[model samples]
Target: MYATIGIIVYVLLYTLINRKQINQHSRKKWIYFSLAICAGAAMLLLSDSSVGWLTKYLNNTIGDLTSVVISE
Candidate 1:
């Protein structure tokens, strides 16, 4: 319901913003951003009661990535 509307609005807004350079290539980038936003929104919505858990998970993920980069 709301998610569907949100996706529709996002598509409309994205199309308007990239009305010029929105060919096949750049359009793929838009789809990626939209998917990221949708995933983030879904996570937040599903874990509204687990904010602390999500924060720690995200922090650990970032820390691990940084550690790997630093080690390499």
Candidate 2:
């Protein structure tokens, strides 16, 4: 599907654009934590039910930090 391709392109583009930052962050646990986000996106290609699950999971996990970052 198109979404799958979009995800692949986005990941590749993002990684390419942020290669240095990613390498710099490689020593941090948060780098691996970020992969959970990609996994959640991939889940969307598998089943519709994953939408709610990932939404809740991401909101619980990353939501607060995103809000904090944005408010700054």
Candidate 3:
């Protein structure tokens, strides 16, 4: 649930970011800054979720692969 919400939030943030004009060399740092903020916020939103629960999303096989890759 939370994971899905987080993913949705991330996608929304991505769309919002892409619609803006932030592709200048002078604002290069803002690109990373915005992405970091979006990722952090989305992760925090999904922090209550369990890994197993999250892996049950649409991309079941891919989710399992990602879980293994991120399992530290």
Misplaced by over 4 Å in model 2 are 26-29, 51-72
Report, for every candidate in turn, its global Cα lDDT versus the true structure.
0.68, 0.73, 0.66
Question: Which pairs, if any, clash in model 1?
Answer: none
lDDT of 2 by residue, 4-71 (tens): 66776787687678778877874645764575478457657866675688788899889988999999
> Better model by TM-score, 2 or 3?
2
Candidate 2 has a TM-score of 0.45
Candidates 1 and 2 compared: the better one by TM-score is: 2
lDDT per residue as tens, model 1, 18-67: 65665556467877677567746654554446567877897799978999
Weakest lDDT window of 10 consecutive positions for candidate 3? 43-52
The root-mean-square deviation over C-alpha atoms between each candidate and the true structure, in angstroms, is: 7.9, 10.3, 10.9
Comparing 1 with 3 on TM-score, the higher-scoring candidate is 3
lDDT of 3 at 69: 92
Q: Where in model 3 is the C-alpha error above 4 Å?
A: 2-20, 48-72
